[model samples]
Target: MGELAPTVAFLTGAPTQGRIGVGWRTLRGLLGRPAETPTLTVAEVDTHLGDVATTSGSGSAARRSELLSHLLARATSAEQDFLLRLLTGELRQGALEGVMIEAIATATGVPGDLVRRAVMLSGGLAETAAAAASGGREALLAFRLELGRPVRPMLASPAESLDQAVEGIAEPIVEYKLDGARIQVHRDGDEVHVYTRTLREVTRQVAELADLVRGLPCASVVLDGETLALTDDGRPRPFQETMSRFGSTREEQVKALLLRPYFFDCLHLDGTDLLDASLRERREALHRVAGEHVIPGEVAPSDPAALLESSLDAGHEGVMVKDPDTPYAAGRRGRAWLKVKPSHTLDLVVLAAEWGHGRRTGYLSNLHLGARDPDGGEPIMVGKTFKGLTDELLEWQTRRFPELQRGSDDWTVHLRPELVVEIELDGVQTSTRYPGGVALRFARVLRYRPDKEAADADTIDAVTAMLRG
Candidate 1:
């Protein structure tokens, strides 16, 4: 598996193919083949994993992948495959979280509910397990929300219809769903930080957003919301424009496209933690502090269709119907909140494309759609589709996508997640192969959304939400 890229590079006219353009190719050539003699031990392999985990500040991108690749080349083919999967975080062993929690309970003699709660609160199963096993029940109970640390954002399931969502929750608070990037603003005194949904610190990129948070009327606060770039007319710009600013490393470029934050839920305020607070409480706090910055929402809408219409007319994505009394359930797609949209379309990143067949030959036909990871990692592959392509699109993609190529094989060309495409899909289903555990069903390309970035793509939670509805 480590050789996949180096081999493709050689076949596809890569520069300095003999060296893999890094160190790994030479290391592999030196190792020759898996030896009959067992010189390397399991401990030696484990040591490499630990070393890679700790080593940092090494220069250049290719050097880093090659650094790990060189360590991996010493293993046998099967071991190399396992190591590759582990490195990519795609090692699916079919281990259930529920089962792991039960094992933690059995091993620690702590209550299962306590262990589960600690895992949810801490957002680290391994750490939770270690603490439970060593310190017992008290340690698990003591887990609390930290001030600067980001808690997993609560997720919502999709609603088949507004009526279905309203029916599920008697009275729903509907808020317009802005098409933008999720931002978690944390402020302590004058210190302000901004994070993406994946928990990546982007404070430096969105400095204007941090300044806005610093002006909030609270000593310390943690606000969960969305930020989007707006045009001169005060309308939200294309998602691509928003991401260009959000992901920009250059200060001047980011300054050119300032992001405006709309606070929705307040997780913490005035040195008091509100993570356990209900949506009603959070909304009240948000309104009290944010004032004009609070997202425009309607209470107990008499006409659901009318509300959805108003949201769409305002150029928003859709309406989110949330139960007021439900507590903030971090890291969970609970039934407490439901989202209703006009159509089942998602902004997905193009991970790769397969060569077309027959009349479509020489064109990039099939597309691999990926959703954003909440924990700030690589986009996870959900599924592939070749439907809904015009001849113009096929020709354009054939000529265009190779410019963004990362790696390639005979049948497929892997790409960096630079291009975002709008996709219409039936829904999602459970899948063992995809890291998201759900795959798009009947997915078809709508068009390439040049205005959106990979960071603006819909999340894996959004895909999984379709499974419930």
Candidate 2:
């Protein structure tokens, strides 16, 4: 417990990638032999984290870092890794980030709200609090403050259907799920900061938006909004096009794409926290602050059927049905917000596979998908997708995929097209990348279909019909 305190604190103050990377490295160093990797069961870690959270500011950043450094200086490599996992809040095999925060609160005996508020403002956990509770204030002063800490974007849980969202709210406002990027705008007097979904500083990427926001009606404010790239015809451009425009380093190329800022919620207006206010009140505040920058949309009746129809007519992904009674619940996936997208599934065959990068390294995880033929027996390759896979899935595939491997290398593993997988795709588009003359866009692995054989997968004709529809 003594050693664990400081490591967790240091990690809370470190950059997201740096904290995780350094923690992993420290863990490996402690373990001496890689085979003796230290593993902390979720139950065990969760218990201690909960204690730390409740322990009266014991999880503060300065204290946690001091405790971590003190402990790491004396720990075996394996012990260090074990401690690192606990501090970085990456202990579980299928854990959500929110769960980790809960464990931290439980460990320190600190209030979850205090921990969350500290983390959100500091952009990481405050290990110093934990240290102060354990090692005293002098120990906390040894740790330094790191700026621009990145935190995971707050996520929302999916609703069963549009009807589900309307049951709880009286008047629902339907917003387009723009196939664009999310931007968090923070303003302090004349200074402004723009952050991406992953909390990366993207101020330079959307300089035009920053200038426009500077002229906004508020003095000190924070806004949550979307930056969309619209086509010349006033339609939303393809997501890939928007990504390319943002990723482009050339000023001329970036300027060619027209980006519009659409404000959705006003988090802070003139030093008041509107997050706890109802959606109706927040909407009023957002409109007041945004003025012309507000998205050209209407607050519709709380009818799921009508909202769904309107969303389809607008060619948007789907309507976001939000609770009019709830306040802003950041970093928490509550029932207050729900996204209903019209999606379908297709069973496809594996054409090839690729090794994963970063945390997924050493696993043949990415899959190339193909559809079968109804008229003939041949399969046509459509597209490839790698997202939506869990660590358990990666490990399972790494072991099971060897039997299906046709060719192998450290970076890639070509398969024999023997396995079938069910995949969810947002839509299909004409593409020269695949032999079928079309490709599945935004394809995600829903599940591996062992109950059905490869021959039972969806046919190319079926996919073609879907594209036509």
Candidate 3:
């Protein structure tokens, strides 16, 4: 009951056996096992669900199809309908699983916060719910930061100015915020895994970085940091250059565009979980095992503005002002950490795009941008721009956006709200043109946020807040 395999099955919707692809329509047409056979039990169905995740061979897909057909065949009609819904990702047992935390707390009499924290650290609501229901609060609270399973990362709220960023935070720790991809590294002996800010494992793509962490002086540790490709002079390459390395596993491709790691915070060290420790304590732990590998920063500097200039002069993005007294707030964004970039940027979703003209002919040029709706609704359009697309980017968009297209016209291609892009703008202005009653001023594309999804885009609330002052 605690296993996440079934949940994973529910989420992925289908197995990796693309060759023997099975969809609802295909399954509906196929015959199942004999009707006289004994009905499938819950435990037997669980076994099949677990095996579907890792069962791969030259002929494994057909075997998996048989298992699913048999499970459905022996089930009651109602149960069969439920299984089909789960396979199609339409089973909303709770609104996308977050509601399950509250349900578990209510049923088990354990705290909802306890269940949520356990889920965040363990990355499995099923396991946490089982523990809570079986052994109550003590077992629910027993979940620790697992080494390999990626925990949801803490995020930062964007600040309007440097003073505003550090206004209420105490004993600020100013670290150079380099323009790079965020990474979470887990090291256990010689085995190491590297995950992106979204918690997707990229260890296979960046195995060299994993090897570097394996050499660090720690038996088991988890470090939060950033990685980027640097020039021969040791300056960061463009953000696009760094991101281009995340999807490849080729030896020549990986080796040619090598990435370097810069650790900032330690979440675990030497068998102790540091998730509850202060940033100062965690930074010390980070320095102990990764002195040379730590990100460059100072604790409560007298001249934080000067440091910001130095960061910019050195070709970095800006400085991150952090509160040294704060603990690692996993999976939440609060005032403890603030990013101060030179210009304003918002992560917006691409609602659609218009075909190009003139020199931009044959490419998708102008993009329609939309801010996320916090009420679980579709994205609300704020503005459109073709101001920042380079030749390479235009070509990439023309190729990429079509794959995600939902519907299109002669000039504009409407798409599913899938690609999140970074946008830099002067400010927001009141406007009736958009549903949010606010529009971005002089907006230009900064970069595409491949690491983010539509849900993670800056909310309409965040965008409208800029119009306040």
Report lDDT (CA) for all predictions.
0.72, 0.63, 0.80
Which 10-residue window of candidate 2 scores lowest in summed lDDT? 89-98
Clashing pairs in 3: none
Q: Which stretches of candidate 1 lie over 4 Å from their true place?
A: 1-32, 35-47, 53-77, 92-116, 346-352, 357-363, 368-422, 426-442, 446-469
- Residue-by-residue lDDT tens digits, candidate 1, 1-469: 2333222222222211111222323333334354343455544554554454445564644455655666655667665644444332232211134456677788779998788777666755566776776689998988987767676677667678888888866668888888888888888999988878756678888888888888888898888888888888878887767877755779788767878888789988887778778888888888888888888787788887888888798788888888988877654446688888888988788999999999998999899888876554678889999999999889989998786666899999988666789898888899998777888888998778654456557778778878885
Indicate the worst ten consecutive residues by lDDT in candidate 3: 11-20
Candidate 1 structure lDDT: 0.72
Report the lDDT of model 2 for residue 279: 75
Given candidate 1, what's the lDDT at residue 225?
Answer: 87
With candidate 1 superimposed using the best TM-score fit, by how many Å does residue 434's alpha carbon deviate from the native?
Answer: 14
Query: Model 2 off-target regions past 4 Å?
Result: 1-6, 9-96, 127-154, 300-304, 344-469
TM-score of each: 0.73, 0.58, 0.82
Predictions ranked by TM-score, top down? Answer: 3, 1, 2
Worst 10 residues of 1 by lDDT: 10-19
Ranking by lDDT: 3, 1, 2
Predicted candidate 3 versus true structure: per-residue lDDT over 314-430, tens digit per residue = 899899999888887655447888899888899998999999999998999999999877654568899999998999899999998786666789999987676899999999999
